[model samples]
Target: MARKLPELKRRKPSIAEQQRFILICEGEKTEIAYFKALKAQYRSAQISIEYVAPAGVPITIMDKVKARMAELRREQRSNPSVKADTVWAVFDRDEHHKVTEAIAGRQVSGAQVAYSNPCFEVWLVLHHEDYHASDDHHQVQKRYQKLDRAYDPDGSKTPDCGFLMNRVEEAENRGERQCKSREDEGMPFGRPSTTVYNLTRAIRAAAEASRPKRS
Candidate 1:
């Protein structure tokens, strides 16, 4: 009889664990909708995107973010997996007086700020074209609508995610270029600039990490 081969142990395939990201937004509808759409587009088994829209000024939104961060920390003590890998405070510099305070609060709370000057619509406008002019929320919104007729034509203030999602890479590139231009002009936090691309970059990184690896 042929000798039986020794039994070999099979190694188990590792399952990817989901990374948790918590985002607190100042806008009740538009920002929330945009981020939700982003989460849907980059849906993955190994990534979790959560949003909290406090619908307030930058300082108030930062307060909510701090509270949520505290709650998550407490939860992590019992279950470490519940810990959030990153927390972001999303807000616009729309003539808000406490914008500086809110930005400073991030250092103490260890949360990142995805701030847009004039308004969040500045980011939306970047998806279609490069904008460097100083404009308020109204102007930016009008420009966005002009660029994409399908966006908020009914005054709903909701983003057209279908049109926006496909152009994320283009927006990111344009935003980064504008940021560089601003820095070169010695106005790092100038109007018509947005750090929203930084937040999106983080989201994309998490999604990429969640992708399955081929043997």
Candidate 2:
């Protein structure tokens, strides 16, 4: 018999890289808080959400995002392998002149915008029922209260991201319908429209997809 058999080398399994996301929002409270809750809900180590400082206006928010991104690039000089899959700026058009500028400005840094015309509340209201009005910030809240009885009219109460997330699909479909209607009316990305659902869906899907499959 052959004395010594050659030892076989075992192959190492491939480990997929984590999906990286950098989210910058105009609102310090709602957008930031909502995204934070969303990230926690997934509880996936394969997904990363970078935090940027709170900004008030759309242009200012874009400024902060670009600054942070510049910092990241400098960091890459040392790390040499750091990369971000997506960098998104979430903002609303609430009579702010800079909103349009900010959305168009994303081309400079290659960042994407999850824009909601009129206000972010449009996206939030969609979670409850169908809304196609180009309502201002206040009206959006009123509509949201109809769905969420616990909603507080005063500034004291915070957003209900958990409740909204539970019906994310419904909200997403409604938002799509609104956008489609706007587009058909020659007003794409105009009032009564929101692209927040696009960002949410991508985050949820990518977070789940990056995880290793279990037998």
Candidate 3:
């Protein structure tokens, strides 16, 4: 018999095949730090996370996110398998009128927006206790002060700040209740609502799903 053909080498799957979460945020550091913390806490190794910030105001953030994702997809044509599995935008409803437009407008390339009414600090405050008052971001900061006097608005979180990561589940429950209440009522945009919790839940689910089986 002729010599056996040389064994063919199999190409292993590259890291590019892994699932990814693309995030565009309004803040440069706080949201980025928070997500980085969540990624670590959840040990989401299977899912790659890309966060883009300093992305301008709400509407601008949306535009940048869509444009960047489009560029990525165009470059990824060589390997369609390498692409963002999920895309999301995180922004606060502070004085930004464009926030509503960003929310109501059509999602770009199926990217979802996670907007916190008043401000994202509201979601952070919910970690300690439930709040439904229709106040602005400063008021939300006050609530946070009750839990941690050293809270900083410019994205400074000390070691104790890490505690918020532990109470994520509690925060999600509280936030969902508020979100449902807002939906039931006829409240408009920036009226004490937040979808940050939902985004967190989605990330958590993706992380769990990406985990390898024990067997």
Maximum-lDDT candidate: 1
Per residue, candidate 2 scores C-alpha lDDT tens digits across 1-215 of: 87998888765545467757777777656676677778777665343444445447788878877886787777878887765557788888887886778888889977878899888778878887788776777888788777766666576566778766678878888988999999999999888899988888887787677665643
Q: After superposition, how far is residue 199 of candidate 2 from its true place, in Å?
A: 0.9
Once fitted onto the true fold, the runs of candidate 1 whose alpha carbons sit more than 4 angstroms away are 1-13, 45-54, 81-83
Candidate 1 per-residue lDDT over residues 95-159, each given as its tens digit: 78989899999998888899999888889888888999888788888888887776673477577
* Angstrom error at residue 169, model 3: 1.5
- For model 2, which pairs clash? none
By summed lDDT, the worst window of 10 consecutive residues in model 3 runs over 45-54
> Clashes in model 1: which pairs?
none
Q: TM-score of the candidate numbered 1?
A: 0.86
Q: What is the C-alpha RMSD of each candidate to the true structure, in Å?
A: 3.0, 3.8, 5.7
Among all windows of 10 consecutive residues in model 1, the one with the lowest summed lDDT is: 45-54
What order do candidates take by TM-score, descending? Answer: 1, 2, 3
Candidate maximizing TM-score = 1
Model 2 backbone overlap count: 0
